[model samples]
Target chain A: MKILSTLILLVALALGSAQAQKFITKSGNIRFFSSTPIEDILAHNRQVNSALDQQTGDFVFRVLMKSFQFEKALMQEHFNENYVESDKFPNATFTGKVTNIKDIDFAKNGVYNAIVEGDLTIKGVTKKISEKGTFEVKDGKVIGKSTFNVLVEDYGIKIPGAVAKNIAKSIQIDVDVNLEKLE
Target chain B: MKKKWLIIIGGLAAAGIVLALLVYFFVYNKPHKDYSKAKPDFEVEAIAFFEEFRTNAAASSARYNGKVIAITGQLSSVEVTDEQVVALFEIDEGMFGSEGVRCVLIPEKAETLISIPPGSTITIKGHCTGYNETDVILEHCSIAI
Candidate 1:
């Protein structure tokens, strides 16, 4: 009888906490860099839309392809027309969950290792990926950041043979976002 | 023979001048169209702009994507950082829910944006990157004249 009442109390507390566990960030930063022999090409998309369900560890990130700004206008034009083809593929997304949810405490402030496994889609192609990331709670806000690499060919992005030397096969990706509690 | 040689040299000089002029006009002195100085393609209300996308994303993107647009809307939030100033506008529920129209303003012109409070009406001009699933994002934004 005593164990049954304790279990019920724990369930009630979890339910209460779940209601306030959603976090959102409208301006997250997602950047990618490619370093090749001919040139080092990189772009930063500061308009990433992301949401996190803290109770369930569910995460989703979306960003417009045209939002990735380049230093050179010609490169930006080529990237839109030839490379990622922003007109055809408007956004890239990742929908997944933090796999190591049990180790992190939401109510407290700390840096915890998080492993995220999800479907990452780019250029209308989706791939299953698992990567290690970090979750840091500071000043009552959750900050999530991660770094990974993806090959251009992996996402069905074609690089022409002539300029292939200018682009690296693998591109490094970086993400940073400060999440606000969803009201 | 000497007269013919002089005429040939003179002709070569004239062709060189023309080539240089062409390079100056077409290559070196070409105009640079900055978004700050360029005219906006469209001026729209935030609600109406988002409504078009919500109704027909394909048509809206075809018309508005990759163009310089000016949008008027209420500021939902503002974020200032060392690098840039970001302004966010709400547009009801989007593909999933909770739609937003976000504008990233010019760093040099961020001073004019300080006085505007959240929920105040403002017009911003920028390059419309296009609508993602949840947000319509603009880059190189500035306070509209």
Candidate 2:
């Protein structure tokens, strides 16, 4: 009976440690900027959902396209109605892995550079992407941040000739998320 | 006679320019919708609303996305910050995490939000941003009195 109890305690400890390997944030922030000579457009979405698995190096982000708020209502309308078509494709997701997760020590309080490779889906189109970001481990929280440029045309978003000058061909995307331990 | 015609044309040109400026200001520089004052398109209980999404996400999203909705439920949790207050309504426990209606309240309601204890029933009105496979996001939320 003693040996059996010891085995059960060990199994419970293993499960507890496994749970500690996951971190998540439901209120992540994602911003996209499009700059042109005629106009500059920027939108922010604070309802991003992201998760990271320390053991597997798996990272995932889910962004609701409709949650993006723009300064100009017209821009937001056009972005949803004509650009990304939020009615048809309401969410954009990134499912990838941190290639260099081994180098980052989550137990230590410091910022570490990370490379993530994953499939990014936008407007129902999936594209493979590799981006560089930083993970800051502080106060038992992990803050992940990254900025990258995505070509508008790559996602099959066609700009009309009339408003082409108002929008940029490539948009700069910024991601910031503070993830807490699941337990 | 020619001078008179030119004056009329000039006056019309000036009026046209003024009209163009008005259109630009009203259409292009229009402000975002103030959800605090706007009436919700749908008033639903939090559990029913979440179940609709879980049962048929595509149809629920079509009906609710980008629309202002009022949801009443027991507050499961609250995360307060200087910028905003986020309140969660317990929906279900998924493999990844707990799924629910997550409302991001306007910064002005931070004080009121913090005072409310968890498990208290409340109604939140905001713009629904559809389900992210886990939580149905609501932004610019206000406590519906």
State each model's CA lDDT, in order.
0.84, 0.93
CAPRI classification of candidate 1:
acceptable
In model 1 chain B, where is the ten-residue run with the lowest total lDDT? Answer: B24-33
Q: Model 1, A42-111: lDDT tens per residue?
A: 8998778888887788999988888887776677777889988888888889999998887888789999
lDDT of 2 by residue, A1-183 (tens): 999999999999999899899999888999999999898899998888999999889999999999898989999999999999999999999999999999999999999999999999999999999999999999889999999999989899999999999999999999999899997
Error of 2 at A78 (Å): 1.4
Instruction: Provide all candidates' interface root-mean-square deviations.
Output: 3.6, 1.0
- TM for candidate 1 is 0.83
Write down the TM-score of every candidate: 0.83, 0.95
lDDT of 2 by residue, B17-123 (tens): 99999998899888889999998999999999999999999999999999999999999999775456898997899856789899998888867887899999999
* Candidate 2 off by > 4 Å: A1-7
Q: Give the winner by lDDT.
A: 2
- Estimate the Cα RMSD of every predicted model relative to the unseen true structure: 4.8, 1.6
Task: Tell me the TM-score of chain B in each candidate.
Answer: 0.76, 0.95
